[model samples]
Structure formats: C-alpha cells, structure tokens
Target: MKRTTLAIALAVLAWTAWDTGADPIRLGRGIPWLLDFVRRMLPPDLRVLPAALVGALKTVEIALLGTAMAAALALPLGFLSARNVASPAVFHPARVALNFFRSIDTLVYALVFVAAVGLGPFPGVLAVVAYTTTSLAKLYSEAIEGIDRGPVDAITATGATRLQILRYGVLPQVLPLFLSYVLYRLETNIRAATILGFVGAGGIGFYLQTYLRMIDYRAASTVLLVTVVMVMVVDAVSSRLRARLI
Candidate 1:
C-alpha cells in the first residue's frame, strides 16, 4: 500500500510539472539572460537613496499602524471566538467571520481599499488592518482556547467573575504568545506593505514600479537594496522582542 501510494505521489508530481510547463530546457536557456538582467541592475544608483529612504519609511509606517490597529480590534473579538470563553453559538459565527477575513488575499484587500480611498499609504494601511485583524483574531482565539484551564478553574472556584477570570487567569498565560504572534504578523505585514505600492496603495513599491517602468535598473536596484535592509533590520528587532516576550 505504501509503495502504491508513493508511486501515485510521484506520478501526480510528474503530471503537475508537465501540466505547468516546468521546462528545464527553457530554464537553462534563460540563465544568461537572467545574468544580463542582473548586470543591468549593477552599482545601485545612490541618487535615488533619499527617495528610497522616504518610501521605505512610509512602508514601515503603514505596516506598523495597520498591525497595531488590527491587534487592538482583535483583542476583544478573540475572546468571543474562543471555545472556552464564548458559547458554541457565538464561537461558530465568530470563527466563520474570521474565516471570511482570512479567505481573501492581502493584495485583494489592498486593491479594494485603494479604489475606495483613491490611492496612498492610507489604503495600504487599511488593507493591512483588514488582513491582519482576522489573522491575529484567529491565532488569538486558538491561543486563548489552548491555555491552561487549571488557572481558570482555580479562579472560578474563588467566585471570580468572568471578567476577573479573564484578566487574572487568562491574559497572564496567553499574553506572551499573543504578543509573539502580533510581532510575527508585524514582520509579515511590513514585507507585504512594500509591494502594496505596486497598486498605488503606497510604499517603496511605487518607486520600484516607476523605476521598472522606466527600465532604469540601477534605480530599481537601489530601491531593492533599501527594501532588503529595512526588512532585515525589522525582522531582527522583532525577533529579539518576540524572544524576550515568549
């Protein structure tokens, strides 16, 4: 049975690869052109540095504000979605709503908000907020539900109110994991916000797209460099903060 299953898996993989036009020959033919393209992006034009800085900063701002807003909104809603805290009636509906939020792509949200707001970081931030809220809400609910029930039970035995049980018992246990999840999402959102500009939602992506359209590879390379550095720094900092938190 295992051998048959393995054969089926291999056959499916081969079929999928063939169907997708995953041609190794075509890829081999493109190597030199890829090298030439990289050559064209050489030396990273410093002239675009100031503009790149501004765009990168804007991207960071969008991600930061969006993540913060999402975290705030998700906090209370998370309790409503938790199986332990809320009744099955509320839990199912809340889970469905969060699932709805998660089902849509981040870019879709950005595009919709961009159309509504007429383009800018505002739309990008809104997109981030919308995407992140459901994501974090779901994670937060799972964390809440998975927490040690002993603390809750102990608190309840002392005649603690629901609010008191949550505050004194639940929050303390889940706070670290919740904060860690938020930071991880913050890292992801920042990277995503950079490309939000591709749709004019705002960020370094605007400048990157502009350079690409002009075929000004050096300028594009500069933007790429700035983006890479910004992402690396943010990731490092967030990782450290999360390590301490969790």
Candidate 2:
C-alpha cells in the first residue's frame, strides 16, 4: 500500500509539472534582467530625505486608519463566521462570504476605491480596510474555532444566552489572539498602502510613481529607501506588541 501511494504521488507531481508548463529555460531568461535591475538599485540616494519623510508619514496614517476600521468591522463579523458560534446552516454561507472577500487583493480594492473616491488617502484607507477585514475575519474565526469549549459549556449551563456566553467565555479566550492578528495585519497594511499610492490613492508610493514617470531614478531610490525603513520599523513594533499580547 505504501509503495502504491508513493507511485501515485510521484505520478501526480509529474503530471502537475507538465500541466503547469514548468520550463527551466523560460525561467532562466528572466535572471539576467533581474540582475541588471538590482545592479541599478545599489547605493540608494538619500538626498530627498525631507520629501520622503512627509510621504512616509502619510503612508503610516493611511495604514493605521485602515487597519483600525477593519478591526472594528471584522470583530463582529468574525464571531458570526466562527463555527463554534454560528449554527451549521449559517456557517457555510458566512464562510463563503468571508472567502469571497479574501479572494480579492488589496491592489484591486484600491483601484476600485480610487475610482469611487477620486484619488486620495481616503481611497487608500478604504482599500486597506477591505483587505484587512477579510483577512482578520477569517483568522479571527479560526482562532475562535480553536478555543477550548469547556468555558462556553459552563456559561451555557448557567442559562446564559449565546451572546452572553460569547462575551463572558469566548471573548476572554480569543482576545489575545485577536489582538495579535490585528497587529500583524497593521504591519501588512503599511506595505500595502505604499503600493496603493501608485494608483493615486495617496501615500509615499505616489512620490515614487511620479519620480519613476520622470525617469528620476535617484528620487525614486530615496523614496523606496525611506518606505522600506518605515515598513521595517512598523513591522518591528508590531511584532513586539503581538508577542506581548499572545
């Protein structure tokens, strides 16, 4: 049986490789171009520090606002989607809704919001909120499912309603995990907001895009460097906070 299973797995892998058009030669052609691009990016310019700093702050604001909005909306939706909280009849539909939202990328969300909001930090914030909500809701629901049931059962035995049980039993167990997830999402949103600016959603990415359009590699390099540093700082802080919470 073990040998048969191994043969089947190898056969499936080989078939998938062929089906996906996994050609080593085609992949190798991109390496030279990538190397040339990296070579040009070396010794990043720092002359545009002042402008970069301003843009970096805008990006941070967009990310923070967006993540906060997402958390507020997701906290409730997460409970609705959790298997432990939701009835079986509702669970499938709720899960499907969450999955549908998660399927869309933040960049795509930014594009839609940009059209609707007419290009600004507002649109960028909305985009981040959409993406972050889907992510947090799914993760939060999973965390809920993973929690111990004893507390919930005990609360129910006391004649507590579902909402009461959730408030008294479920929330206490999941709050730390939820907070950790929120911090992680905020870190991710910072990077996403930077990219959204390229679409005129407003952030440091806008400056980077403007410089690139004018072929001002030095200015673009400065913006990129500042953006990277900002993201690194936010990520470090978020990681520490998440560690403390979880």
Best by lDDT: 1
Cα deviation of 99, candidate 2, in Å = 0.8
Q: Mind giving the per-residue lDDT tens digits that candidate 2 earns over 102-216? A: 9999999999999997988999999999989989999999999999999989999999987899999899999999999999899889988898888999999999999889877
List the pairs of residues colliding in candidate 2: none
Best by TM-score: 1
lDDT of every model, 2 decimals: 0.95, 0.90
**How does each model score on TM-score?**
0.97, 0.85
Over the full model, what C-alpha lDDT does candidate 2 score relative to the true structure? 0.90
Pairs in steric clash, model 1: none
For model 1 the local lDDT of residue 165 reads: 95
Q: Tell how far residue 98 is off in model 1, in angstroms.
A: 1.3
Displacement of residue 243 (Cα, Å) in model 2 is 1.1
